[model samples]
Target: MRPLEVWLYGAGLVLSFVAIVSLTRSIVVTIAKRKIVEERKAVQQEVQKKNEELVKQSALVESEYFVEREAREKLGLGREGESVVLLSPSATEPGIAAPVPEAVQETKSNFRLWWELFF
Candidate 1:
């Protein structure tokens, strides 16, 4: 009778140990999955923000104002018969300094400027 009772107690102990280990493993997997989901959400938000910025940039690029601005800045172009006055960097300061004047021909194209710069 004593031996039979000992066997029953040992079996019970082993079963409880298995149950605890299985529960712990399940908890660990749940935590890992939660972390992965959070990371995925963060990445998605960043991608959405980048997409919004690209949309805004594309819209700006397609606008007529953007084309005019680019032409004027890069090609040194202006409205017909309008004199484009250029001021030297030093002239903008508050100090009194006589700024030398240099005139660019209105007919000179951007290609001519590039040619002069390189050759």
Candidate 2:
């Protein structure tokens, strides 16, 4: 009878430990799944926001004003009766070569450069 009682108690203890472990794992999995759902929701919201911005940009691109502005700025097109005056580059164009002023065109030898650096 004593041996039987000890066996039953040991079985009960093992069963209780298994139950606790299973419950803890289930709770952890539930929490992880909830966190995943929340992350998915946040990503979905960000995607929706990006979609809305793209829609707005698409609308702007489709508008006549944007087309006209892009044409005027990019293609150098002018409206009817609006004469496009061509202006020469005002020292800002990269292609235009200007002579460097003599004062700024000084070339120093290596020795002179070293002397200047030290002194």
RMSD of every prediction: 8.9, 9.8
- What candidate 2 gets wrong by more than 4 Å, as runs, is 88-119
Q: Considering summed lDDT, which 10 consecutive residues are worst modelled in model 1?
A: 98-107
TM-score of each: 0.60, 0.65
The reply for model 1, stretches above 4 Å from the true place, is 1-5, 78-119
lDDT of 2 by residue, 28-49 (tens): 9999999999999999999999
| Separate clash counts for every candidate | 0, 0
Candidate 1 local distance difference test against the native: 0.91
List, residue by residue over 1-119, the lDDT tens digit for candidate 1: 69989999999999999999999999999999999999999999999999999999999999999988887888878878988777667777887697556786478899998999999
For model 2, the run of ten residues with the poorest summed lDDT: 84-93
Best by lDDT: 2
